[model samples]
Target: MNDKFELPPRRRLPDEIRQRMRTRVWEGLGEPDQRPRWTVTVRGRAPIAVAAAVVVLVAGGVTLLQSVQGGGGQPTAGGQATTTRPSQQLGPLLVPGVAQSAVDKCQAVAFAQTTPGDYAEPDRWRPRFSVSLPGREVAVFDAAGPVFCELTRTTVTVSPAVAAPQVLDVSAPASAARVTSLFQTANHTLAGTVDSQVTGLELGLANADGSNGVLGRAALMDGVFVANLPLSERGAAQGGRLLLSATTPTGTLTGSGPVPDGRVWQGTTVDVWPSGDSDPTSRRNQLDRCLDRALVNGLPGTDAEGWQPGARVGSAADQEGVLVAHRDDGQLVACALADQHGAELQLATRIFAPDRTANPDVPVTAVDLSWRFLTVWGAVGPRVARVELVGENTTATGEVVDGTFAVQLAGVTDAAGWETRNVLRAFDAAGNLLYEGTPVIRR
Candidate 1:
């Protein structure tokens, strides 16, 4: 016998609807193999309990399935069900200059911890950029349209390199600077200011033709700099300009301008006396005689016998004044206060033997050694004040008098094994090492 239960007036559902209902039933049962067989019943044809149970199962299954699938099986008012692409974590985006391995590692870590909704548009997500900082730290950024995420790690840091700044500022002098205009003088002083950042300043004297002479350099102190320059007399005669340049960590600045016309000193003579002295007139007369002697002997045309009065005679209180005179040939005659009264007068001149001369003709020509006394005689220069005899183990000193120098040499005696090498040196009134003579052998 056929034991089947069916409701009267059975209606056939569409194939698509039947498939959807089957899918819902399987989904509700959780396991497709565990789904129970269902018997359909028409309205008002079967027992109330059976018909009610069928209605409840079919309604709940259809509602749940439609919600899960976003109403896929049925059409909305728009005529078709809307769908969207599944959200996904995209592959690593490469950044220029960054290593590929680094990008891969960063992407792997970000994707593992990220969810689909973590990004508004997961499909559009990409690596935006990265920065490396100190202490082995790296920052990685991922962006999707307007949304972005920043990931930091302590593995590596890729800091961008920057260049140092080169900035400099310089101000030119308001007027030209001038030194002595005498044909033989070349000493001059220049002063200016530079930017605080500048560390050094160089001044170059160039001829009219643009050829540069010796350059003078000076260090900046609190942004101010001063340089003592010596210009070539020939270059000055031909006309030249001064070039000032300053250096900073970032760059260099340069400026050029005309220098003042150096004019010859036209003064004749200078007189100086003690500032607070008991006898002012006598002191003045003494200084006058001393200066007159220097001009007569030092100058070429001046007659030593016939005393001629100087044109300019100015006195100073401290006896620390400079005596400058101009000759007919434009040569400078300058004398500085050497020793005050009771002391010999001194003058400033380039007449002293040049430095590093082998035979400095210091007047001590012969050394007369004796058991009673020792005498050294020669025409010592007026600038020579004292002479010293230095040996390997002994020393002797002498005083300058009447263009001659003498020393006693008391303890030193002439002996066979006592032979030693000796050197004679001369010093000016100002205690400057004026001359170093050739070696003298003493036995």
Candidate 2:
């Protein structure tokens, strides 16, 4: 039988969809997975579930507030440009880096305007970064003139690969999350989910000392990235993807596949295979995608190349704890810290797409993994849009304990016209659902 699954048809999702989804999965779905199909006995389920719950509660509250201020309809001109009072500001979540003291040691300066008005108008020039840190910086954003940040660090005109350096004061969980969201993996040709959600974020990728030679990019909503998207000529193809490789000095990143929504950097199509082979037509070499500089709070880097791309990523968060997403193989992989104390993480979990009700049996389309968590995300088109979750434990020595489980399905809406519900799912290390709260979408 040609089995086909389908999501419940609807004309439009309500504004509160984002909020309801978050509340349902994150806030404590009340019970854990009854009989999880996957489990590593040593791994517990309590702490992980609790942590996931915390994140859901916080995100849900923010979404609700945004809905109220934004109205239950689409974003308006005012809401799009300048946020009103009691708005959801984006940044390191831990600190606001606009104080004069923050930019004390920077040699050069550049401003990336994210607001809606002209730079001359201070009101339109939203205050994203308050200072410039060592390797973190921004471009003046003059589109026509010299629109790049200044760097004090010396550049070694050697191979792009360099020893990993240190980045200052960027270790908070929020900081790490912001940085990850900023660096859009070229592998995924589509305009990143970042532009749609994050209003402004600063990334700092440089040595500890106030130096230069770091590369990074920031965004204001509906700017350059969005302007070039949903490729005009190139239709949607699931081949393009993004990969972060810390195993190398330069921390190589590879993007492959056709440009689905041709907009930004859409001319040359790129693709990378599972076996690490590339076609002659692929822009694997030309597009040396790397972080030049990043800004957060106020500290922005001027040197576009002084700091190695992965250094900040490594120092700030555990390198082995990488959240890998592969479009080629259609999977999400997370590696554990590969240190002496860290466990050997290589177990990959696979889930069905959200619309899997059509086919009760064959659900998984692709999968990949390294260590901490085995994640899988893909679409079954609108027909079979169900998502399934499965896990595995790949530990050698002692028992491995995995904690925390949370899932977010972006671009979803609710039935009533009150909120947008973005489906949220939480599972334990053993692949058990701890909480299942759905939150309403505000922005």
Question: Candidate 1: worst 10 consecutive residues by lDDT?
Answer: 47-56
Q: Residue by residue across 1-443, what tens digits does model 2's lDDT show?
A: 68897876645334467446544543343322331232221111111111011121232243211112222122344323322121133321222223332232121111231333222332222323221323333212222211212221211011001112112222233322221221111222112222223443333221112122122232333222211111221223322211111111323221122222222322121222222434311122111111111111111111122221110011113332222222322222222222211121222222323433553322222222223333222222222222323212121111111111112222222335412122233333455443232222121
lDDT of 2 at 415: 34
Q: TM-score of the candidate numbered 2?
A: 0.21
Model 2 accuracy (lDDT, Cα)? 0.24
Point to the candidate with the largest TM-score.
1
Task: State the lDDT of candidate 1 residue by residue for 186-278, as single tens digits.
Answer: 123222334567665666565443343335564234454434433333234546555566566766666555544433321111122323334
